[model samples]
Target: MSRKATITQKEIVNAAFKITKKEGFEQITSRKLAAAAGCSTQPIFRIYENMDGLKKDVYDKAAAYYEDYYNDFNKTHEVPFVDLGLAYIGFAQKYPHLFRLLFISGQGTGGRSMYDLVNGSTENVVKEINKATASGAGNAQQLFMQMWIFIHGAGCMAVTGDYDLDEASSVAMLESAYKAFCLG
Candidate 1:
């Protein structure tokens, strides 16, 4: 009779996710994952065809974690449009490992174009921008894209430790970008 396995695929994925969250995706070797999961490397190989497969699952988990974190920030903040950008930079500041994994490594976007990436996921953000700035759909979208460029740049800088940004400064920059984008 075959022996029952003590660990599930979900458990292994969870362990990988934790490792990736704390130490970045590059750290997730089979041996490391097995150690984190308290199992042998054989189970990891049995569950996943290779490390890419495991990393894909870990990427999905990291993406979901980011969505929840970003959405929760938007829900509570008074200025969802500008504040959302701050929250993004804030995520990079707080979770440099996860931020690098999700954004810097370019794994999250897959092959999607920037247009689809922003427009597809950020309809509500556009709506909020429209309401706040009284701009029409096209202008709101343009403004969102413009501000997102700044926000994403700031996030990258934060993740790379290139810039040490404080909330007050980030908020000021976001507000300025919002106004500038609203003009053009």
Candidate 2:
């Protein structure tokens, strides 16, 4: 009779997530995951068809975690979009490895265009933009795209450790960009 598996898929994923949290997605190898999971690599191969499948699971976990982080920030702020932008940068500052894994390195995005990315992900934020500025959907989308470019840049900067922008400065910069986009 075949022996029962010792390590579960969830447990392996949790170990992979921990490795990703500390070392970024690129560092997730079978050997490293085995070390993290405190088991032989055989269980990982048994659970996942290949490393790509495991990476996808890890990416999904990171994405969900980021969404929760954004949602938590939105709950406390007056302007959700502005606060979301701040939260995006703050997330990068706080979790640079995850930020690089999710955004900078293009682990999950694949070949999707920026247009598709914003349309698919920011429907609620666009609605909030319309409510806040009374702009039409087209204008709101435009503003969001513009702001997203700036916010993405700030996030990248935060992860790179090149810029040391404090919260106050970040808010001022976000406000300036928001007003500029709103006015134009």
lDDT of 1: 0.74
Per-candidate TM equals 0.85, 0.85
**1-184 in candidate 1: lDDT tens per residue?**
9999999999999999899888888988888889999999999999998888888788777767776776667444444366767767888888999888777676654664333333335555655676666534346656666777887898888888886867777677777777666667
Clash counts for all predictions: 0, 0
| lDDT tens per residue, model 2, 1-184 | 9998889988999999999898887788999999889999899998999988888888777877876776566434454267767878898999999888777776664554433333336554655576566533347767777888888899888998976988788788887887787778
Q: lDDT of each model, Cα atoms only?
A: 0.74, 0.76
Question: Which stretch of 10 consecutive residues in model 2 shows the poorest summed lDDT?
Answer: 111-120
Q: Residue 63 in candidate 1 has what lDDT? A: 69
How good is model 1 by TM-score? Answer: 0.85
Show pairs that collide, candidate 2: none
